[model samples]
Target chain A: MSEFVEQLALCVERGKVNRESLYPPDLHGQDGTDELAKQALEQGLKPDTILEGCILGMDRIGAKFSENKAFVPELLMAAKAMTAAMTHLKPFFQSGAVKRKGTFVIGTVAGDLHDIGKNLVAMVVEGGGFEVIDLGTNVTTAKFLASIEEHPGCSVGMSALLTTTMVNMEGTIKAIKEKYPETLVLVGGAPVTKQYADKIGADGYSPDPQGAVAILNKKVA
Target chain B: MTSFERLQNRMVGNPVDRPPNFDIMMQFATRHIDKPLRDYYLDHRVLVQANMAMLNDFQLDIVQAISDPYREAFDLGLEVSFPEQSLPISTSPLLREPSDLARLTTVDPVNGRRMHDRLEAIRLFREKVGGCTPIMGWVEGALAEAADLRGVSTLMLDLFERPDWVIELLEFCCEQAILFARAQMAAGADIIGLGDAVASQVSPAWYRLYALPYERRIFQAVKNSGGIARLHICGDTTLILHEMATSGADIVDIDWMVDYQKAAEISDNDGPAICGNFDPVKIMLQGSPEQVREAVINCLSIGGDKNLSAAGCEIPINTPYSNLHAQTAALSEYYSMA
Candidate 1:
């Protein structure tokens, strides 16, 4: 990694939110992701290089979470730190300078009002440089279709926490496939299983936010 | 041996004629018998009748009065939305900002809407069948109650953004839970059921820091209040099983995703009994009677006869009657032979 990019990645890994924030116990009172990203940009680091660093840091955290070395709280801290850095690269993204790998549209399927899992996936995926369109909770099939129409060629993810609402995932998957046969759909939740995903005809199923990132990366890479 | 004797014996880890079966029932099913959701939770008569229905209808060994986690949250002044036949959910969430804690007041269990309702239910259960069946009182574990108070999203963020605030909130919730558990024991609950489903969402480290201490405190409080404590977390808790076993509960109810054999291995302590690992949906809600029997047999095989029972989480509200019979039938067959 480039020296500037490596510094950016370290800031994210350590959850250095900004120059002013005091956290992580170890890194208190130090320059954080915000200052490092700005410095990287001023030093003429390419936007893609900075973006790659964020992705690498996020991936490392994701793997740690999957392995049980880190928890949701730590992952959220990393994601927050990555978001802080990404803010510096926003202008580049807007000006067509840094391109996102693909678009991912996600929501908690109809009848399920829970959004924690869905929101976590959205945050982690956004950190991975994907244009994420979050539809929020209790999303109906019609609403999902509308999102797909608005962002054509976007991959879709459906989530449900309640067992009763999990049935709605099947309906949403069917509706999306019938209307847009080519659109890839993913499903997940506490009650959702790989078997249920296969039975529902979804293209993928991830048990955790990191798994979702891996699936999205494989699809768009 | 009678179901009551069997369960009592198992509770102390004494040798039983055979393993007993216990299941946590959902309050939403009370609506099927014409009781409103809130009324079923509030009225002692309604709570007793509903639980009695479960015992008489399914021959369950233990009966519990559990409504929803939103009860404490609602009494804490959070807005809650209650559907006709579903669990009540908090609308506003308690932890919008760290400063919101100062504005929040602790609810007295006697005067609180949700806690009082649960207490009334426990009282009714004791009056109706105190000696015949074990009655379980319910409280949300610190993590789950905190999630209900703080929206799940904000709590997840707080875990990252504000570690100190998370610790403070969990401590406050634990203090409240001890008070709640004491009141329930006074109202005649034999066992206190601690619901901490949200803890399953976090990794083991977060669970160890934010959940385990509070759970141990609550469990110790329940025991000190002259009631046995049962911990019921509804999700895949495999990752945190070992830590959870150390919470000092008398019974640990395992959800569908956790293998009972794995839980038994992790629980290493001999005091707390392991209660379940069946998939309520697959076997109880939508399976044939034979399949249900087979599933119970499988669960029992994995759980073993010592300090084990039948159930996963809250038995699904819409589980088929015949499938439920199959669960009892399997239990009866096993115990009768023993």
Candidate 2:
């Protein structure tokens, strides 16, 4: 709740990456998340406390997106700001001075080259404190299994933008569950619905990025 | 009545034999004719064959030239690759930096290879079904073309990072789209469908600022050229439904996530005809014929007089023939009862 931490949260929420960043003109020439985080740490603030600022900022922007009060541009800017602040916290995370919520592996299912929806969820989830492993586009069932083996207990998220490709999510989920029965699975995209998620036996379905964060948080909680 | 007459009449709330089956089918059409997606995209002859098959077999009323979104981007110097069995993709965006905007040139649709291919398709459609069916040619919405050339995420960030540059890029894209749309119209297209799938992802404010004006311009050009303008934006467009209604288009595609009743209410009496609001994945692809029939009936009932029958977007390529038939049958049955 100190001055720098508060400003850092504001910077992330407004998407001001640094002082040189001209975005969000209201905060022009002001210290961004990068400077605020460094200053907060130099003043002996706990890394965990500083991390709270990032989470709070992302949560605020994520909620706005969910309510239709904001859109992809705002969320992308917030993620960029969060990434700028995370650069300063990376060493703390490596040294075990900070901890992440969980791991979420995501990808666009096979035969569907669209990645905008998948990437949005990955960025928002990362800002929500999860370690995200984005497998990129055209991901097959074998790739999902391999990533599960690499990151044990990591929840999986699959995306498909086409109706034809959405069926691929079912086969991919079935293959993942067959190998790692305990791994949580989620499916989402423009064509995916909650009913289809249930039909495909996915653990959860989210219509938006913050909704994905909520689902992932619920499972771990 | 001819398919062309049915569609034109339906848009103006005139009585027709049945609601026009305006389902957007590209992959499904390719599968119906058993052609590779690449052939369907790159070869106008293959595209014409696929569409003709859909018209004969599934009662589809529109012969469309919408193979992929890359035609404009590719002709504008973007690196596009068409996999044999997959949709086209542009791995490397053309505008990597803000200054890269200078690299874009105004492309003549008639001279550009991919754009010319679409014109060829329009010409063929006119030759084959000129008077009987509506021929729809397509172009990307300006914002969508910008996203295609600059990448979705980067352009999104650019909207905030460099507002003026984004506007300039949009202006360039708008000019190209207008040119491509005009070319198609000249080549015998009765209707021009503009796909702005990325527009649904932006907030209403951004949509009004960056997307709507360009859409207005393109639709205005289509109308001025004596062509029907159809606007198709994929995904849940509930928030911007009102704005979409005012975009100068004659028909606006309503995706499944949007409420059909709400769309009709928002458009009211003076707006464009509502063309869809069914779950292409759940009800059309995965549902039985009985379910598809009921969904079409329900959608048409909600959409009222100014409605065209269609799935929310493209039907899945593997959709059962019976399910597709159910769509046409439902229209006939519903209208007969009324």
Candidate 3:
């Protein structure tokens, strides 16, 4: 990696968004991922290089999260940092100068309003260089199918916090499989288990956000 | 001995046959009475009837009137959405802005709409079950209530950015918690279940500084009012076990993520009496009776005499009846051996 990419990656890993951001107090008054990514671009650094830096940083944090070495706040801060870098790259993506890895549509399933878990997964996956289409909470099976149609060949992730709503995962998974048999369906949440995932014919299940990124990466790879 | 005596005796170090089993059950109880969950939770009469019926059928020890965490927030002038088939959720936080705390006022449990509903549930439980069963009243702890009033994500970031705002919200929460718990005591609740499930989101150090002090105040109020306090924290709490023990509660209800071995070590024979540590979904809801028996036996050995048997958190509504019975049925196996 180039010097600029390495610095941007370090900023994302340390959750430094910009000099004005206050989350990681030790990094205060420092140029964060937002500033460094823009500077790197201004200096003619490749957009792909900056994106790879984000992927590298998110991979490190995602692995840590799966090991329970990191908590929600750390992951959120890291995602925010990645978002800062991604904002500078968005114009490149729209101008066809950059290519996204793939689309991953995610949502908290019907009758379940909780979104923190789903939001975390979306952020980490986005930082992994995927274009994430997040359909917010209380999403029904029809909404999921529509999202899949909007982003064909996209991997789908469903979350449900309540045990009552977890049962809905089965129908959602089955419907997606019925419509797009080749599409991957991922299920997770507080009440979701590997056994339940297998029972519902889900392609994968991850207890944490990092694991979700790993699974989505694997299936697409 | 009555269920109340069994628990009360355990509280004061009196010998009891075994540790009493107390669980927070609303969805599970509604399944027993065949009422829609919304119906059961909306009316104190339905909530009381469904709980008593579940206690009798499951052979559990407590008749608890605990519902969702949105009750107190609802009474504080926040709109709570009631889905016909799911638990009630707060649609928007009561304190969206820091200055909004000025508009907030302490709620009178006897006259407040949702708080009064819970009080009536307790009084009705007292009338019907009397001293035969221990009745528990539910109150959201400072951190949990603050999260509800200001939205969870907002409150979490506030802890890092605007901590003063979080503290002020918590102080306001303590005001409502005292009134809620005290009214339940006057209405004949044997214990107060202080729920701060969101504390699991932060590290033990953060919990100690931001969450624990306010919890200590609420527990002190409960103890002063002659009502025992039970601290219930849901989700993975392995890191915060020691800090959680300092809340001055009589019992700490743990979740599955913290096994009984960790609970035993954290308690160190000095912490609050420990109850639960079983996976509500995996062990009680989906597992067979034999699996339930095995888990109970394992928990008993790990807990020794200071443990109570319960699901890690709220018992799921879809949990099997045989699995529920096995929790109590296996207790006999442990008692006979001892």
User: TM-score: which candidate is best?
Assistant: 2
Cα displacement (Å) at residue B3, model 1: 3.7
* Model 1 bad stretches (over 4 Å): B15-18, B31-46, B266-269, B336-338
Error of 3 at A1 (Å): 2.9
Where does candidate 3 stray beyond 4 Å? B12-15
Q: Write the per-residue lDDT of candidate 3 for residues B1-338, one digit (tens) a residue.
A: 88878877765546677667776688989888998889876899999889878877877789888989987899998889787778887777778788899999997887798899998999999999878898899899999998888887778767766777778888989889988999999999988999998888876777888789988999899999988889998888888888778888878888998867888775555668788878899999889999999988888788756677787898898888888888878877777877
Q: After superposition, how far is residue A131 of candidate 1 from its true place, in Å?
A: 0.7
Provide chain B TM-scores across all predictions: 0.94, 0.99, 0.96
The global C-alpha lDDT for each of the candidates, from Candidate 1 onward, is 0.80, 0.91, 0.85
**Per-residue lDDT of A1-221 in model 2, one digit per residue for the tens?**
66666777788889999999998998999888888888878988888877888888898899999898888889999999999999998999889889989999999999888888898899889888888999999999999899999999899999998876888888898888888999999899987889989999999999999999999999889
TM-score of candidate 3 against the unseen true structure:
0.96
Deviation of model 2 at A96, angstroms: 1.5
User: What TM-score fits each model?
Assistant: 0.93, 0.97, 0.96
Lowest lDDT 10-residue stretch of candidate 3 chain A: A66-75
Candidate 3's error at B100, in angstroms? Answer: 2.3
Q: What is the lDDT of residue B194 in candidate 2?
A: 95
Q: For residues A56-174, what per-residue lDDT tens digits would candidate 3 score against the true structure?
A: 89888888777777667667778888999899998999898988889999999998999989998999999888999999999999999999999988999999999988998889888
User: Per-residue CA lDDT of candidate 1, range B284-325, in tens?
Assistant: 776789998887877776665454555577666667778877
The best candidate in terms of DockQ? 2
Please say which candidate is ahead in lDDT: 1 or 3: 3
